[model samples]
Target: MPDLDPPKRSRWTLWLVLLVCAAPVVASYFSFYVLDLRGRAYGDLIQPTRDLPASLALTDLKGAPVAAVSLHGQWLLTYVPDRACDEGCERMLFMQRQLREMLGKDRDRLDKLVLVPDDVNLTPAQIDALTAHGAPATVLRAPRAAIEGWLMAAPGHRMGEHLFLVDPMGRWMLRTPATPEPSAVKKDLERLMRANAGWDKPGR
Candidate 1:
């Protein structure tokens, strides 16, 4: 009987093929998650990844239609709530303002955005209150369905309980913990700005 053994050359070829197929994916993860990384990210990464739904559309407070794509190219700090401002909504607004202010010179690269779910209107008084608070937030009227697609409730939580972060590249990159401590969230934002320093600049 002839002795049988796996061919050395075939084993080498199989290993080479596996390495080639995996190299790009490995390199990309390294570049994004490890290489020269600087951000103090607070949100845990979802393994499968979640993103902003493309189908969702929103209108500004003025009724001007805006696409989710409009948020691209800026670090967006977003809050979702009904049009009628409540105490919780007020707190979110305040936190957003504080987070932006904490950025100091890098603040301009960030946008404070509020997405109002449903057709509920913002009364003049409500608008004035937000303005009076010195919060330069852009309030948009979004369909409830669209809003829900992006902002989710934790297992037993509600949408507005947490603040979400979007990167300059338009990815819903982070979700600060529910009722995150402002100081901690500020540090996370600052670290993100620092990490992307080479790419992101202060502007519209």
Candidate 2:
């Protein structure tokens, strides 16, 4: 009779693969919840973290296709902007950029994302503003409904009024107040960086 058992080395390889895939999720949970770090987080810690939806579709300003899953592998400082791109939008953009800068050496591990929820035509100046300061942000357009389904805004406020933070694993884990204090947001970013240092590194 032929042996049905798998090789011991093959079993070890499978277990190793599973551990590698689950490390980030485990680290995040232990750092934020079990350690009571949630109490210290400036941004509201989302219970039952929401994973990035595979069905979410996105496109660039020029209408080129962009995959939503492509955003995984970096901490995301996300802002959902209106088609108009008014004063509030500009302020949020500035704040998001500055918060990443405040990360100091860990900056590259974080990416700034401006998700436009409409098809409004952006003037050259608007595009320049988004890419200003040498550190360009990834600006993409997705359907308003898709954005609404992914990011949660504070009660009595629209999604554009707040900033959302997503983990490298593509999970939506933090949501700031409608008008977040930059200093407070910075502290939260720093804490997360330190907590995940063992598993996360700069670049993808």
Candidate 3:
């Protein structure tokens, strides 16, 4: 009959070629996720790099569309609050601004984002107040459900209870505690900028 022996050396060579082609990708994944190499992070990893859902949209104070994509390429310090601006919301806003300022020169590398969940209507005087207290933050009005997709509650906590951190690539990276101490949060921000120095800079 025809050769009953296997393809022998040719089959072995083909298997070797396939393994060689996949080596780099496999090694990178191992080094990054499995092996926990030196540069690997201890921080929580958000898979798939969540983006602003397409169904979500925002409007500026002037009633113009504010594209969610505008947030890309800058480190974002985000807060979710209502237009009514209660005492708790006001305190959170102050903390967000102060935390950015505490970054020193690195402050320019970050942007403050306030996601208002409804069209509660801000009077011109109220707008003036927000601007006066550095509240002219990149305000965007989105549905409460859409905002919840990214900013989640911790255990019994709620979304508006804490400040969220998003990296330049638009990945939700860190979540500061509800009762965040400014000095402690400042250290965390500085650490992030320092670690990402290779890819990020101190401005837009």
Candidate 4:
């Protein structure tokens, strides 16, 4: 009589493979939501996150329609300012560039979005500053009222004072303080990137 045992070896192999594939997703979830960091996010994580509106329309400085690439498929470091582009506005622009550059090899995974209120103008110098961040540095004209509803500012502050982090899924995930501390903001960015390593990659 031939031995008549179950195919335990094949069953074990299948289970092993499934575990390996699921490990990353489990780990990512734990790191992002379950793990208890000393003080939550370095930048205040927006409680009850908001989604980027699909119907909201934005145009470039010349009044041309903006591209979809700016709003989706990559993490966004966003700033909104009045047309004047004052000293504070210029500083925030520089901060956005600096923070993205600080991401180093992961920099390409991020995009900078400057929402131009219809009342505001994008000066030549401002345009030059944006160009320095490389391709797809988005500067677009959008309805101030509409955009404000999505990205909330720090209490007692205007929208321009804050820098926002939009997840690849088009959600407003985090908002840095009115006066950003680069080190603090960078900590928040690095943590998210590390946690999302399982699903997120350098490009898009």
For each candidate, the alpha-carbon lDDT, in order, equals 0.71, 0.84, 0.68, 0.79
Candidate 3 at 28: error in angstroms? 15
Which regions of candidate 1 fall more than 4 Å away from where they truly are?
1-32, 35-40, 46-49, 82-84, 119-121, 131-135
Give the CA lDDT, 0 to 100, for residue 181 in model 2. 97
Model 3: per-residue Cα lDDT over 1-204, one tens digit each: 564357776788888999986575456434433454233443333454466554567777666887777777788898876446667777887888888888878888898887778745555664565566643567777777678876675677766778887766666756777667777777667666665555466555
Candidate 2, overall lDDT? 0.84
lDDT of predicted model 4: 0.79
Q: Against the true structure, what is each candidate's TM-score?
A: 0.74, 0.90, 0.70, 0.81
Candidate 4 residue pairs in backbone clash = 83-120, 83-121
Error of 2 at 137 (Å): 0.4
Give the alpha carbon lDDT tens digit for every residue of 1-204 in model 1.
664356966888899999986675456444555653325356544333456666677777677888877777787898876446677767887788888988988988998877788766566776776556654677777788777776675676666777888766566757777777898788777666666666566755
Better of 2 and 4 by TM-score: 2
**Ranked candidates (TM-score, high to low):** 2, 4, 1, 3
RMSD of 3: 8.2
**Number of the top TM-score candidate:** 2
Off by more than 4 A, model 3? 1-49, 119-126, 132-136
Residue 57, candidate 2: Cα error in Å is 1.2
Instruction: Give candidate 2 misplaced runs (Cα > 4 Å).
Output: 1-4, 7-9, 119-121
lDDT of 4 by residue, 1-204 (tens): 665356976788889999997787568746865573336777777656688888778887778887544577888899999548899998998899889989888888898888888877777877877866346477788888878778878878888888998878788868888888998888878887788788776656
Off by over 4 Å in 4: 1-30, 36-38, 67-70, 132-136
RMSD from true fold, candidate 1: 8.5
